[model samples]
Target: MIQNRSLARRGAAVVAAGAAALVLAACGGDGDSDSSAGHGGHKATASASASSSASASASQGQRNAADVAFAQGMIPHHRQAVEMAGLASGRAQSAEVSKLAADIRKAQDPEIKTLSGWLTSWGEDVPAKGAMDHSAHDMGGMMTDGEMTELENASGKAFDTAFMKLMIKHHEGAVEMAKTEQADGAYGPATRMAGEIITSQSAEIEQMNKLLGKD
Candidate 1:
């Protein structure tokens, strides 16, 4: 009977040890699973954060509707200014008027190309030459067809006076548009250009006023 009890005790100890090992194995498996799940969750969160940052960066760089309008509207405006400046080569009586016109052409021509490039990159349509003719009067300080015709027909001192007056009006319009861009645009380069336009054109306006003998 004692021998039987000893054998039975040994069998019970073996079973108990086996059960403890199984429980330890199960707990180890659970820990490994939790660790793997934690690692996976961290990777997923990191990926999501990276995606969000990329999206924000793209959004910040993207042009908005106001930027498109600024570029579109300014292109034709610059074109008209350039055309008017071209007429001053031999027709302007005052050397100052001629110099001003040349400067306008020089400054605005490159701007036109730059604006065109922006529109092209953004998949926006650029304004065709003379596109502003029909709607010029509606824009701020843009000359009517009649006024442009008159300027084109004038010469000598008459040409100089007309050029200064009309150019003052044109510069004013450009300044206003620039102000709107500064106020409403989201593009960094465009808004910076707008600020530059406001400063330069405002100075030009003052200069024209002095030339025209206006306070």
Candidate 2:
């Protein structure tokens, strides 16, 4: 009877050991599953962050391109107009002609500075110092050096008449260019400014024509 009792106890011990082993295996499996799930979550978060970064980078690049082109094109255009205005201010005999030139200079100088600031911010080259190919693009009403010289040498009524004629042409050209930009320019600020220029310059053109009795 003692032997039989000892055998029964041994059998019970074996069953308990098997049950413990099974429990340990289940716990290990649960740990592995949790670890795998955490790794997957990390991967998903990393992918989302990467996509967001790429989208932001693309948007910034587009903005930079638009800003650069606007500054590059506009700087030279403004410089030429300012030069013409300076000549008009000095040589124009009519009060209307002088005032118009002064107004142009006032408006354009600030615009030039604003555009230059954008160029600097974008790390783009400012206006090139050399002579630009005004002929390459239909730069409206741009005078040659000879034409400007003639205007500078004229006096009295001739100066007034010539200044009015030249300035009218200049403003017309600018209006056309501004219209082009309004249609095609990429940035919000640049397109808006282009529209404004078109409206303002068109009105100025009409005023100058009226002043010259050409209306």
Best candidate (score: TM-score) = 1
| Residue lDDT tens for model 2, 16-81 | 999999999999999999999999999999999999998876654445454566567777777877
Tell me the spans in candidate 1 whose CA falls farther than 4 Å from its real position: 1-60
Best by lDDT: 1
Each model's total of backbone clashes: 0, 0
lDDT of 1 by residue, 115-197 (tens): 99989989989888766655656887777888889989999999999999889989999999999998999888889888988
Cα error, residue 43 of model 2, in Å, equals 16
Q: How high is the CA lDDT of each candidate model? A: 0.89, 0.77
Q: After superposition, how far is residue 215 of candidate 2 from its true place, in Å?
A: 1.8
Residue 192 in candidate 2, Cα distance off native in Å: 1.5
Clashing pairs in 1: none
RMSD of each: 3.8, 4.8
For each candidate, what TM-score against the reference?
0.74, 0.66
